[model samples]
Target chain A: MISIDKYAYNSRLRRRDPMQKLVFAMMTLSVCIWAEKIIISIAVIFIMGGMTVLKGGTPFPFFLRLLLVPMIFLLVGVFTIAVNICENQEMLLWAIPFAGKWIGFSDASLVKSLKLFLRALGAVSCLYFLSLNTPMVDLLAAFRRLGMPKVFVELMELVYRFIFSLMETADTIYNAQNCRLGYSSLCSSYRSLAIMASMLFIKSYKQSKALYTALEARGYEGEINVLEEAYESHWGWYIMAVAVNALLVLFVIALKSITGGLS
Target chain B: MNENILETKDLHYIYADGAVALKGISIGIKKGKCTAVLGANGAGKSTMFLNFNGIYRPSSGQVLFNGKPIDYSRKGLKELRRKIGMVFQDPDNQLFSASVFQDISFGVVNMKLPEKECRRRVDNAMEQIGITHLRDKPTHSLSFGQKKRVAIAGVLAMEPEVLVLDEPTAGLDPIGVSELMKMLRQIQTTLGITVVISTHDIDIVPLYCDYVFVMYHGMMVLEGTPKQVFTQKETIRDINLRLPRIGHLMEILKYKDDFDLDDSINTISEARIALKDWKARYLKR
Candidate 1:
C-alpha cells in the first residue's frame, strides 16, 4: 500500500489533472461493469494495464502485484458462483456426492462465473489506473472541486496527513521498547504494546490540539482551504479518454449483435 | 519611536489544569530584528509564542502588536495572523498536508488570494528557502531538515511581517543548524521581516540573534543583546540555562587561565580578534 502511494506521487502521469484521470477511470470502470461481454472486459483490462504501465511509468511487476491483491477475494467469490448442486450427472464436469446430493461444476455455471470474474477484474483495473497515477492530495483537491462535502474532504486530508506521522511514531516507540528488552517475552511484549498504544493515543490527542493551534495561527477559519493544484489541462487527454471508452462501447454492442444477445 | 513590533505587558497565562505557564511576564520584540527567546524545556517559551499571535489569550495581561493590544475578534485575529505567522516546533503538526506544495500554500490560500498570486507566493517562498526541488516531494518522504525548511516556507509564503518559530533548530544536525540560522538571517535582512525564535540551543543564539530574552519559570529574568545576556554567566546559570560554549570558554580563559583578554567575546571571530590584540599588545611583557 505504501509503495503504491509512493509510485502515485512519482508517476510520470502525476502532473496531469486528477479530474481527467478520475473521469477516465470511472467511465472505463462503468463501461466494463455495464457491458457484460467477455471481450470488452478483456479489452478494458488491457487498456487500463497498458495506460498505467506504459504512460504512467509504473513498473509492470508492481502493477501485477497490486492486481494479485484482489485475486484471492475474487476467486473465493467466483468459487461459490461456479459450484452447482444437482441430482443427476448430466452436464457435470466434476461431481462430488455427499448425503445423497451431488455438487459439481457445470459448463453454464463455469462460463457465467468466468464472465463475472473478468468483469470485476476489468473494473478493478480501471480504479488501479487512477490510484497508481494520482496522489491522494490531488485526488482530494479534485474532490473538493467536484463539490464533495467540505467536512468529509477535510477529515480525509487530515487523516491522510497524520497516518504517516502516527506510523513513524509507532515504529519509533516499538523500537525503543525492543531496545529496552521490554519485548523479551510474549507476555512482556503484550504489556509493552499496550503501554505504547496508550502513549500513542495521548500523543495524538496532544498533537491534534497543537495542530489546531498551528492552523489557527495561520488564519484558518474553520476551513482546510489550500491552493488548487495546477495540472496540465489538455483537451487531448479528455478526447482520448472518451474515444477509448467509446470504442469499448462499440465493441460491446458489436459482440452482443454477433452473439444474438446471448448475455 | 516604536521600535518594538511585538510586546507583552505583564502577561500571564495559566493552563486549564491549574498550572501557571507564564507569570506576569513582560518583554518587547523589536521590528525588523532577529530576537531569540532562550529557555529550558517547559519554561513557557511556547506559551509566550501562543500569546504573540493571539493563539491563546493572556490570563491577566496584554499582548501588543505594533503598539496595539491584540484584538481577539474573528476579523481582528485573522488580520493579526496575516501579519504574524507562527511556525510550530514540530513540522508534522504544522504541516497538515502530505504534499509540500499544498502545505506551503496553506497559509496564503487562507487569506483568499487569487490562484495565480498564491502560486507565485508559494514559488517565491520555496525559492527563498532553497527548497524548490522539494516542491513535489511528499512531506513524509522529506528528511528532518528538509521538512523543517518546508515548514518555514509554509509560514514564509504568507509573507508575514513577524515570523515566530518555536525551537527552529531543535531536531537539526550541526550543519543543518548553522545553515538554517544563516538562511533565516539572510531572509530577515533581505526581506526586513522580524524573526522571533524560542530555543534551547544557546550556541546559535549568540551567533544569529540580535537580542535575547531569557525566560525562567515563566518570568523574564534578563533581556539584552547576546553579549550583555551571556556575559552574566551566573545569572544565566541560575535559571537552568548557561552561556554559549564560546562565551563560557572566554570567561574561563579570562578568570581561570589569567589571560588578560576581554571575556565578553561570544563568537570565534571575536575571540580571534581579541586574542590577536592581546598578543600584539602584551607579547613583549
Candidate 2:
C-alpha cells in the first residue's frame, strides 16, 4: 500500500487533473462490467494495465504483481461457480457419481465462471489504473470539487495524512520491544504486542488532541479548508476519455449484432 | 522600548485534572522584537504559548493583544488567530494535509482572502522557507528538518503580526538549528513580525533572541536580555538550564584559569572580540 502511494506521487501523469483520471477510470469500469464478454473484459484489462504502466510510469512487474493480488480470491470464487450438481449426466461436461446424482461442471458453467473472473479482473484493473496514477491528496481535492460531503472528505484527509506517521510509530515501538527482549518468547511476544497496541492507542489520542489545538491556533473554524492546487487541465483529456469509452461501446454493439446473443 | 503587542497579566492556567501549569505569569512581548522563553521540560512553556493564541483560556487573569484583552468570542478568536499565527513543535501534528502547498495554504485560506492573494502568500511562504522544491512532495516523505520548514511556512503564510513557535529547535541537527534560527531572525528583522519562541536550547537563545524569559516550576524565575539573564549563572543552573558553550568556556577561563577574559560573553563573536581586547591589553603589559 505504501509503495503504491509512492508510485502515485512519482507518476508521470501526476500533474494531470485528477478529475479527468477519475472520470476515465469510472467510465471504463462501467463499460467493462456492462459488456459481459470474455474478449471485452480481457481488452479492458490490457488497456488499463497498459495505461498504468506505460503512461503512469509504474514498473510492468509491479503492475503484474498488483494484478495477481486479487487472483487468489478470484480463483477461489470462480471454482465454486465452476462445480455443480445435476440429475442428468448428459448435461455434465465432466462428472463424478455421487449418491445417485452427478456432481460436475457443465460447459455453460465453465464459460460463465471464466467470463465472471475476467470481468472482475477488468473492473479491478480500472481502479488500479486510477490509484496508481493519482495520489490520495489529489483524489480528495477532486472529491471536494465533486460535492462530496464535507465531513467525510475531512475525515478521509486526516486519516490519510496520519496513517504514515502511525505506521512509523508502530515500527519504532516494535523495534524498541525487540531490543528489550520483550518478544524473545511466545508468551512475551503476545504481552509485548498488547502493550504496543495500548501505547499506540494512547499516543494517537494525544496526537489527535494536539492536532486539533494546532488547527484551532490557525483559525480552523470547524473546517479543514485549504487552497486546491492548480493542475494543467485541458478539455482534450476529457474528450479523449469519452471518445475511447464510446469506441468500446460501439465495438461491443457490433459484436452483439454479429453474434446475435450475449457473446 | 517598543510597546507590547501581546501581554499576559498575572496569567494563571490550571488543567482540568487539577494540575497547575502556569502561576501568575506576567510578561510583555515587545513589538517587532524577537523574544525567547527558556525553560526546562514541563516548565509551563507550552502551556503559556497555548494561552498566547487563546487555545487555552487562562483560569485567572487575562491575555492582551494589541493592548486589549483577548475576546473569547468565536469571531474574535478567529480574527485574533489571523494576526497571531502559531507553529507547533511536532510538524506531524500541525501539518494536517499531505501536500506541502496545501498545508502552507491552510492558514491563508482560513483568513478568507481572495484566491489569488492566498496563492501568492503560499508561494511567497514556500520561497521564504526555501521549500519550493518540496512544494510537490508529500509531508510524510520529507525529512524532519524539511517538515519543520514546511510547518513554519504554513504559519508564515498567514503573515501574522506575531509568530509564536514552541520548541522550534528541538530534534533538529546542528546545521538545521542554525539555519532555521537564521531564517526566523531574517523573518523577524525583514518583515518586522514580533517573533516569540519557547525553547530550552540555551545556545540559540543568545544568538537569535533580543530578550529572554526563564521559567521554573510554573513561575517566571528571570527575564531580561540574554546578557543580563546569563549573568545569574547560579540561578540558571539551579533551574536545570546552563549558559551557552562559549559563555561557559569564558567563565572557566576567567575564574579557574585566572585569565583576563570577559565571562559575560555568551556568543562566539562576542567571546572572540573580548579575547582580542584581552590579548591587546596583555601586549601592552
Interface C-alpha RMSD after superposing true interface residues, each candidate, one decimal: 0.9, 0.7
Off by over 4 Å in 1: B282-285
Please tell me how candidate 1 rates in CAPRI terms.
high
Give the least accurate 10-residue stretch of model 2 chain A, judged by summed lDDT: A254-263
User: Model 1's DockQ?
Assistant: 0.81
In terms of DockQ, the best-performing candidate is: 2
User: What would you estimate as the lDDT of candidate 2?
Assistant: 0.94
List DockQ, one per candidate, in order.
0.81, 0.86
What CAPRI class is candidate 2? high
Cα misplacement distance, residue B202 of candidate 1 (Å): 0.9
